[model samples]
Target: MKKQQQLYKGSLNTIIMKLLENHGRMYGYEITQKVKEITEGEMNLTEGALYPALHKMESEGFLDVEMERVEGRVRKYYKLTESGVKETNNKLEELESFVRNMQQIMNLKLS
Candidate 1:
């Protein structure tokens, strides 16, 4: 059984971008599974959420998709464009700063 994760706001884009950066290219299901596995099943991404984000990123010119036949099915694999690499860097920096500010405001103490 997978543990339910608390809904953390506004980091999915960063997560997806970072995943692409490491993996080079991935299909949608693979991306979702990788995130869930890496988080030890904490984060389960829904197709509803993942597809829309992927489409938005595609529309934004941050991602390029290639279609390939896999097991008699056409799978769309997503890869980062040059702009995507730049965006990923920016998003990561933004997320890091946001987390830092949040820690400060919440007085998060790590032992």
Candidate 2:
């Protein structure tokens, strides 16, 4: 809905993985609400994109899943695999570097 949301698309996985890295496991709905709360609704992850990404990461062995029934509904929880933990660290470093580089470029243009 906002222009900044478009810029966030590329970092969705890093966001999700980092959250899981810190918070243990989480379900899809929980992940959505958490992101909204953290960013004050500036960033959102649609179910359409989220599930596919979760499945892809699972298939790639970056995430492991467990299903449980909560209030008569099944919920799938995702957590990082051993490889995923390592990847999260690498992703965080890359993301931080990108932010620093972007900040430098923006500061140059502003001056």
How would you encode candidate 1's per-residue C-alpha lDDT over 38-96 as one tens digit per residue?
98877888898899999999999999999999999999999999999999999999988
| Residue 70 CA displacement from its true place in model 1, Å | 0.9
Clashes of 2: 0
RMSD in Å for all candidates:
3.4, 1.4
Off by over 4 Å in 1: 1-9, 108-111
**Candidate 2 lDDT by residue in tens digits, 7-105:** 888888899899999899999999999999999987888999788888888898999999999999998999999999998899999999999999898
After TM-score superposition, the amount by which residue 19's alpha carbon in candidate 2 deviates from its true location, in angstroms, is 0.8
Q: Tell me which residue pairs clash in candidate 2.
A: none
Alpha-carbon TM-score of each model against the true structure: 0.88, 0.93
Candidate 1 collision pairs: none
Best by TM-score: 2
lDDT of 2 at 103: 88
* Local error of candidate 2 at residue 63 (angstroms): 0.4
